[model samples]
Target: MTRPTLQGHLDGWSQGDDLRRDVASAVLALAAAGIRISELLAAGPLAGALATVRGHHADGDSQKELDVIADDLVREALAAAPVALLGSEEADEAVTLAPAGTLAVAVDPLDGSSNIDSNMSVGTIFSILPFVGADSLLQPGSAQLAAGFLLYGPQTALVLTVGAGTQVFTLDRATGAFLLSEARAFVVPETAEYAINGSNLRHWDGAIRSYVDDCQAGTEGPRGKDFNTRWVASMVADVYRILVRGGVYLYPGDARGGYAQGRLRLVYEANPIAFLMEQAQGAATDGSRPILDLIPTHLHQRVPLVFGSRAEVERIARYHGGASAMPERSPLFGRRGLLRA
Candidate 1:
């Protein structure tokens, strides 16, 4: 049987609606840009120091050469689509694409750019929402009409959802098309793996530290089951792995100066990921709250992101709420043991 192409999928969904058609156009544009980006990344160093630090965002995140290039590529592609506002991580302000268009697009043009030099997996995450004048791009994740990500890895793939079940499509280099790979992707509710930056254990709050500690304890500890740990330092890669297999990914806020609110952007990163996770039968949260329900106060605002297997995510929330079945460490040691005050 012939596999359905991305265009075919979008065409079937957009049929007679103008807004849906425009949204489909924007998604197609993103897929086209992803193809170009995958090719550029395949060239590695031949692409001329794509990982070189060109500058820094206003928030101090280093802006790499590839980040700017990917942003330009995505913007140029969206220019032909009916996109009114473009909110990109590389841009300090949202760009007005088509003043009269009805769709607002938020994107992390080049996610995981730090992995560029290492030939690690990276991706582009996008959220499509209805244009509602000045506050169109600031709407909460729950308002998203569609969200997805293009993974440029061993095989370039597109994982998407349009208020329907999440689906996966892989690029067929020979045909130059994205063909259906997984028609209805679902996240397994339970998991025996997790991803997080373990080095920050010292700075994490009691909840995060407690969760990690329990996972580390294995069958001999509270969970009563051995668990594996995986951290690619790339959100897209880690989340993709969890979506395919079963696991949990956490980037929680800690006591650090700049990282008190977490590092991922709420609009382009966490929101889109949360939307996809929920669509795939998974869950996402900012520790104790649902990620989709959180309202964005600004475009570049950061928030703690924890997503993956539903049960694991909820358990993490319970840990945060101090309602876990695990025994407390003791008040003498403070909230997180004898680590600090």
Candidate 2:
């Protein structure tokens, strides 16, 4: 039997719900970007046509040539759809279109662009929310009616959540459509894997440092288990691996300049992924609090993001909460104990 296309699934699930047309339009825009991105990647980054667009995005991230192209493609597509305000990382302010529409869309046209030169996976992220004038666009992740991301990896996939369950769709090159591949996707509540940039270990707060030390301790530590570490640097790829198996990812706030507020943008990156995590029986947080509960004061607000299996995420939270309670001296502190504590 043939698998259902994204539109088919949306049509069936959102038949009577509000923002049906708006959601459909947004998905189409994402699908279009996925196709274009595949073509660009295949053509090779060194190609002059895919050269960097001049200057930087509003968030101060350097813009790649493909970033500019993909941004325009999505903007035009959504502008012609039911999306009222288009907020993007590339734009300084929201662009109002379809003034009468009931939904707003915020996008990261090209996430993890820094990995593009190395042929690492990157993706597009989007959040759909109610259009209550321009103000609604700044609302928290809880206000999102739908959120999804498209991964342009070895196999392009779109993982999404519509306040129900999370689902995944893979691009069928033959049909040029995103076909449902995983229904009601869920993450393992516990696993022996974790993802983080270990090179920045010294800059991490006490809670994060303590947690990493435990993982590094292997089966001889307090938790008494070995953990395999993985860090793809690309949020999409890292999170996708967690979705496929089970693991926790941390990009926490550090004391570094411009990073105290956290790095990932709340609107486009954290919010969408947080929504997916919860819908998939997982969790997401900024170490101290739930990610979806965060209210964005600006369109480009950033927040530290930690997400994955429930038990593992909770453990990370424990470390954050009990950082002060951490013993100044421990049996396992500053030394590796062969015997489990």
Q: Which candidate number maximizes lDDT?
A: 1
In candidate 2, how many Å is residue 106 off?
0.7
lDDT of 2 by residue, 165-282 (tens): 9999999989898999998899999888999998888888888887888788787766688889999998989888989998999999888887887799998899999999999999
After TM-score superposition, the amount by which residue 131's alpha carbon in candidate 2 deviates from its true location, in angstroms, is 0.5
Among these predicted structures, which one has the highest TM-score? 1
Candidate 1, lDDT over the whole model: 0.91
lDDT of 2 at 177: 88
TM-score for every candidate vs. truth? 0.95, 0.94
Question: How big is the positional error of residue 212 in model 2, measured in Å on the Cα after superposition?
Answer: 0.4
Each model's lDDT comes to 0.91, 0.84
- Candidate 1 — which residues are off by over 4 angstroms? 322-326, 330-341
Candidate 2 segments exceeding 4 Å error: 46-53, 327-341
lDDT of 1 by residue, 235-291 (tens): 999878988897999999999899999999999999999999999999999988999
